[model samples]
Target: MSQTPLLPSRREFIKQGAAAAATFMIVPRFVLGGKGYTAPSDQLVIAGVGVGGKGESDLASFAKTGKVRIGYLCDVDDRRAAKSRQAFPQAKYYKDWRQLLDKESKNFDAVSVATPDHNHAAVTLAAMQLGKHVYVQKPLTHDLYEARALTEAAKRYPVVTQMGNQGASGDGVRQLQEWYDANLIGKVHTVYCWTDRPVWPQGIPWPTGATSVPPELDWDLWLGTAPFRPYVDKLVPFNWRGWWEYGTGALGDMGCHLLEAPFRVLGLQYASTVQASVGSVYVDEFKRGYFPESCPPSSHVTLTFPATKKNKQEVTVHWMDGGIQPERPEELGPNELFGDGGNGILFVGKKGKMMASTYAANPRLLPLSHNQEVKVKPTLARVPGGAEGHYAQWVEACIAGHGNHTVSAPFETAGPLTEALLMANLAIRGYDLRRPKTTGPGFDYPGRGIELVWDPQQLRVTNFEEVNRFVKRDYRPGWQ
Candidate 1:
């Protein structure tokens, strides 16, 4: 039997590869094609700031494009980052995003920010300021002002940007758009969006006592722009969604997926007026309260959007969460699922009605059978793999450079959508505003009865001054 040849050692393989490459080195496109030259054929190098949970999955999706590389990984918790470190073994690791950016900015072409809502703006803005493309997670930022600032930055800096709402690139939304455009669902006046969320705890007082911080986690760094609080057990990895400082609750979590369809189909922009009502929780045995530190267990918010170029006539959008769903439609069989059971979106129009499930998936005309009867020409181009293609879409767009190709959910579009959601939150929070009573020892909930009129251009609530504080929250020390 012939003996098998031995493989080269790591050092020998590197040296041999280097020698072989030196003989016929290929120049990079930027070097050969000159400044501002990027094409679909080129590769995209990305630095992931929050590489765990959704962050880790986001990076994995990007790398799956086969035209991208994960060059750096950063996360506050070492334990949370263990899987990504093992997957992207060649990537440089860091506990601080600022340090990663400062040291390796020159080596990467784009940045993917899947951090909590509070950290999205600072990391994304810094990357854009460096002229790097960015893909940020949903809700975009912790507050409205940050969303607007990043929206403006996309214009100021020549960089391609996309929000992490993959549903925007789905074929379902396009079909909805086509149906609407074909007048199948004529002049939609109202939309109802509902979700079963807060899979984490909410409506409870902040946990008491300080738990010892995990050795693998950097508590302070995790806080980012949010105010510091003592570390508590089970707050990391998940459960932060119920806290006001770190998350935007169910609306922030599911709004993007459910709202994108209506926005695209009707061309909705900012809301003109917003009103809300919420379910309350009792801190003790006696009285009900707003536990402003935590998101209410459930809420129903109403928003009126003014006429835009694409959608004439005002539209009313209802946002429901915490298992509150709209009254069942009288269209068909009782056994048929309503909006994929737990989550759904229903659009009401003058001529007919249509609906879709979360991520704008499973679209159907009311009566169910109308779906097969209706016919509308598909006018929009589709992303190759639909929702699954979202990551690769951004990669190819970054390679195509700013303005050369359009992404599904660019910052320009995501900003206004995010602002509208945050606007609704103002009402939920305002429901708890207190004032010292004129005579007695107790406080009055003045914000309960009023409708907060919005001034989108000025970016403030014209009627309620108290809730404006949430629009542009102060950054923690040194974060600025």
Candidate 2:
């Protein structure tokens, strides 16, 4: 108490800490274990290409797993990629993704494709061909054909694959399915799903601008495989979500989340019939632009699933988007259910019903009274488990090599989900101007509400030749 030693000044302390951090950064890493991390003989070297936006979060999550060391980072904009590079100082950096893939593929065990929707197939397919495990962001593929092709490619390459729909791993989503299977929601005859998106740029026609390009951006490379077009400020970075050529609209963006539980719970493989009613809330232009070129401002898509001989209850799914929602079910009390912002799937059963959001920690349902007398098995897992983190789950799966496994949202599950999601767009495109409320169960059509029977084995329509034409797409020359 008689003598007090003076502490280092803030600048002095920071300088010393900086030196220590620099020294620690160069040190050899080791495996983290309870007994104290021992150095590993081998570590999975990983590389991330699109290192900003959603990609940055993916990179950080992967880095935290400790199974892999980030060896390279790539992006078109150096400014965007800088933070991720500093986050992993040991990693090399590149502006061009192809250079990263071609030259550095040997250095990496896996590569993540977090680029735009249009470039997903090109980058991910190249990585797969290079024998790297690919973690691609969802809508998985841009169009129906790419969906089928990517699924086939995954089969050919013997590597772990995961879609970036993190909601797939949510215990809440799994519990939602389990609840449905156990008849807690009875037989779900109808599902209403919606997404509130395009917060960046939406509800307008593609901008008309002079073609003078920005120096910072490589517009040609940005276009990638899509049919060539001049650079527009409205269609870059984040706003791509609103463009048809670049992004897949709100339905494509959030459908994977909202539709995931309903699609899984009911085993909905393909829709027999799909139709749409669009308003300009305008239907004519929904599918025309970068986002909703021909899509309506507000549209409702109705999907009909035929009742197989084994199960007679016909399943019907309806998608409502553009900040629109169907009238709340009258059976449920007023304010018992609220629909606004983002997405939710309502499973309407013969008995009780349940509604849950994809990312919801605790998805609650209507009437509150349904909770009484119902005994849920309590098999549901808490939200944040050790392996439940999307990146962590994939890392754990990769380490085990072979064991009891789940693909989170595997291609098999995602295939029909994509089909139905895309069908919402299709219904929007096939909208009839005269028939405003024409898209629904038991509507007037040649096939009643069922358009074409789905042949799961063949992965195509078994009947209705005209409708089958839309199930596939013709790629533009070199792009395919």
After superposition, candidate 2 runs with Cα above 4 Å error = 1-41, 281-295, 307-312, 337-342, 380-388, 402-404, 432-479
Model 2 TM-score, all chains together: 0.79
Q: Report RMSD for candidate 2.
A: 14.1
Residue-level lDDT of model 1, residues 191-279, one tens digit each, is 99999986988888888986999999999999998888889999787888888899999988999999888888899988999999988
- Off-target runs (Cα >4 Å) in candidate 1 are 1-27, 30-42, 283-286
Clashes per candidate (backbone, < 3 Å)? 0, 18
Q: After superposition, how far is residue 68 of candidate 1 from its true place, in Å?
A: 0.9
lDDT of 2 by residue, 146-176 (tens): 6765776666555567887877777767667
